[model samples]
Target: MIEAIEIPTAAGTFDALACGAPGGREVLLLHGFPQSALEWEFQLTALGGGGCHVVAPDQRGYSPGVRPEPVADYRIEELIGDVAAIADALGWQRFDLVGHDWGAYVGWAAAAAMPARIRTLTAVSLPHPAAFLRAMTEDEDQAQRSQYFTLLRKPRVAERVLLADSGAGLRKIFDWKIAEDRIDDYVRRLTEPEALTAALNWYRAMHLSGPTGPVSVPTLYVWSTEDTTVGSTAAMATERYVTGPYRFEMLEEVSHWIPEQAPEELTGHLMRHLLAHRT
Candidate 1:
């Protein structure tokens, strides 16, 4: 069973969801933009059922008390620090990590910053930072796909565009594949005062920071063939950044919302990867 809880970090406290065996090895699941720990409901269930302790947090900007107004606060450094702090607060010297979308970016950052602390990493829907940057700079398809980032970087305009008509634009982004009630829940959480802005600050503060070097931890990267935002170039190039054991799974006809759309497949891959790397 998943339980709602508060996680204190040096930055602030975050609303989080936790599951699985109390004494099991730690697993940290991070969510992406416009999403909360709620997104990992299925993974929590599967991993928790499989005897791994899993915790998914609302992340910096999404959690009310932890939201920092300055865009600079949302920089990659602070974002990575938040993850480290979460680990420190949990008294976890090392943990397995998983992330989706922007969460995947943070996962990559964390693994790069301290590979020793992350026993395994499963990044869904995004490749490593250097690979993505190379794709964005040299691949026209990826560059075109990322144009939305430009709009999201605009502070007030993005707020108006996204929240317009009771979040019609934002709702459309999910393409109605997610249950209406679940989408409503996400919208409700984001529509809270200053919530949307805080979420968008992550995009506004985006910078690739060149190559993060190769990751040494056992890693798995799952990407969908239909992920419009991440093209073949970046997905295929991601393997170069991992010096340790690596696995790449591609889901045919799947969209970018892997955790929600392909929960079983994602869970299977995650379990296999984690179990294989277990010491």
Candidate 2:
């Protein structure tokens, strides 16, 4: 069962969904842009039932209690700090980490900078930041795919377009594979006061392309054949940046929304990775 709870950290109080026995090896899941902890619904069930403790938090701006006003407050460093803060709040000395999309981007950077704090990492959709930066500059296909980043970073305009018509624009961004009720839930949460703007601030705060050290922690980077956001050039280059034990999973025909679309395949990979590396 998914347990909705609050984690009050130095950053602020973040609302979260948790599952599994409290004594099980701890795991924290980070959801990506335009979504919530609810996006991890499937993983919560699978991991929780499979004998692991898992928590997925409504991160940074998504949590009403933790929402900050300035875009500067949402920078990459701040986002990374929140991860540690959350762990501290949960009284977890170290735990496995899983992140998707923007969350994956943050996970890569955090694991690089704070290796001791993260036991293992499962990053979905996005590759290593260093590789991604190289791809954005050198790969025309990746550059083209990232065009939407421009719109999301636009102030006022992004909010107006995305929140208009009960989030028709937001709905358009999601694939048909996602259930309609879940989509509606996302729309309702984002449509709340200052929610959409704060969420978009993550994009405005910093470009995903940046300098990140080689990750030394054991990692599982899952890329999808059909994910238009991250091209194969960056995906292949990712191997160069992970120095420790690494696993690259290529999901055939799956889209960017791996957790929602291929939860079973993802959980299978995740469970094995976690089990193999457990303390």
Candidate 3:
């Protein structure tokens, strides 16, 4: 079973769901926006079965303890710092890392900034920030795919639209990927005004001034063919940014919600990657 606990970070305290055994090699799983640590339900069980400790956190804005009022507090640097703090709180000097969507973005930044602290990186659905920016500007398909981000950048409008009708707007975000029970949990967390704003702050403070160079750690980039949020151009370009051993896995007919939609395939990829590069 996964246990929820509060982890104190540099920015503040955040909630994390821990599974598997303690004192084993740590694997930190970071969930994306509008989601919590529950995103890694399958992987947590699988990895635990393999005697690996898994810690999946709600992240800064998503966790009630760490939500900051200022939008700037959610910058990439700050987000990375929060992950670092969580690692520190857990007494993990080095650990395997996995992230999805916005969590993947934070994972990239953290791995880049502190290479020694990360054993391997598995980023789901999103590419490196530089690769994403290049695609956003140079690829028309990527630009078209990212149009929803523009809508989300609007402060109150995005919140109201998502929270309207008892989170009907947010419920549609899950569509066919997430189960009804899971969607209900996301709705409950996001209904908190601060939680909603803190999640959106990630979009608001996204900037171009972070590390864009190649990642020095072993990495895995997972992409889905049918994902509406990322295009082929950006997905293909992700390989160029990794200087270390890298693997790319493309799932056919899957959407952006990979952990929920294709948990078996995702777990298979993760197991292979982890086994191939165990430290």
Residue 16 deviation, candidate 3, in Å? 1.1
Q: Superposing every Cα of model 1 onto the true structure, what RMSD results?
A: 1.1
lDDT of candidates 1 onward, in order: 0.90, 0.92, 0.88
lDDT: the better of candidates 2 and 3: 2
lDDT of 3: 0.88
* Model 3 TM: 0.97
Report the Cα RMSD per candidate: 1.1, 1.3, 1.2
lDDT of 3 by residue, 110-214 (tens): 888899989999999999878998999999999998998987989999998989899898989876587999999998998886789888988988753356567
Question: How far does residue 115 in candidate 2 sit from its true spot (Å)?
Answer: 0.6
lDDT of 1 at 212: 65
Off by over 4 Å in 3: 208-211
Between which residue pairs do clashes occur in model 3? none
In angstroms, give how far residue 216 of model 3 lies from its true place: 1.1
